[model samples]
Target: MKLPPIGSYISTSFIDWPGHVVAVIFTKGCNWRCPFCHNGPLALGVAEELDVGAILDDIERRAAFLDGVVVSGGEPTIHGSLPSLLRRIKGAGLAVKLDTNGSNPSAIGELLNEGLIDAVAMDIKGPWYKYERLTGKAVDVESVKRSVELLKSSSIDVEFRTTYVPHLMDEEDLRMVRRQVEPGRWVIQLVDTRLALDPALVGTASPERARVAEAFPDVPIRG
Candidate 1:
């Protein structure tokens, strides 16, 4: 069976999954090109590949200590083999969390319908109007909307997040996102410019967590 392209792996992470330790598997390649994206290599498809068998071996050994596996990207849903890979992880008796850009609602729905993933964290990069601008690519706004609605109504746990880039995003933009994903958890993440895809965005200061929290009093601000 063909395996999902595994670009990199993190043995352990406390923050990727709330209240649970997880091993993060980074998939290669992404459809969008958000300027502030820190995982440039993964997005550009330049990251080194790992043998799927080796990765599974490691996961099996660490299963006793791990709560789950986080299938992050470069946009994990882009891979057609993602479902198969997720099934293997689930077969190991570990929970699965998927991090996506919300560009592929069909894939998200398939995974949810098949009971493959336990949680999902999707990036809501501002409002629909600013999607292309922020993502630096022509995007299908409708597809994104579909993904948002799917997660909101699904049985799985979901969190919609936006990287708070000073000039690229603001309180108004986040408010627009909130309106679309109402009654759903919206998290505002502080941008980390240390290794941005767009070199010019490096070193740009992000808004303070408290300041953003004050701006969107009902939302959660994370760094």
Candidate 2:
């Protein structure tokens, strides 16, 4: 099977999956254009292809050490051949976690149905009203909602993440997002505007992690 177009990879990560070591794969291409996304290059399809086969081989050799592999993006589900890529990781006896912008519920379902993915990290771009503004695309908010429900319905360990881009949204918007993603783990990521897709957003203020944590209480804030 042909590999997914891999943009870049992290050989190991401790913070990505929390309490587990995993290699992170950043796939090429994304449907949305979040100005605050750190992965702007990968998302905009401006990355050079990596030797995916070699990366997989390395992961295989190091499988005994790594707890899993995280297939992050650019939006992994956008690729039709994603299942085959995950299948390879599973074959090497490694657990797999997928990161997505939550726009493709069907693809998520297909992977879960096949037992290809062990966990999921889906982003909640913003409150319904500001979806298009935050995503910088014509978003089908319903599809994102469907993906949220699909993840919640499954036994999969799911973490719904939201980056608080103060310029695009406020605390009230975050509250609305918090309300939508409750009864599950939700993380509020402080925007790293320096790496934003839009350089214009550099130095855009994001709330302190402690302040955000106090606001959301029990929910974790990441930056």
lDDT by residue (1-223, candidate 1, tens digit) is 8877889999999989989999999999999999999998899889998888899889988898999999998999999999989988988899999999999999999999999999999999988999998999999999999999999999899999988898687778878888988889888888988888998888888788778877888777777
CA lDDT, every model vs. true structure: 0.90, 0.90
lDDT of 1 at 118: 95
Candidate 2 per-residue lDDT, tens place, 1-223, comes to 7879999999999988988899999999999998888988899999999999999999999999999999999999999999989999999899999999999999998998999988999999889899988988999999999999999999988999998888888889988998898877888888878888888898888677777777788777777
| TM-score of each candidate structure, all chains considered together | 0.97, 0.97
Q: Which regions in candidate 2 have their CA more than 4 angstroms from the true location?
A: none
Error of 2 at 154 (Å): 0.3
**Global Cα lDDT for candidate 1:** 0.90
| Candidate 2 pairs with clashing backbones | none
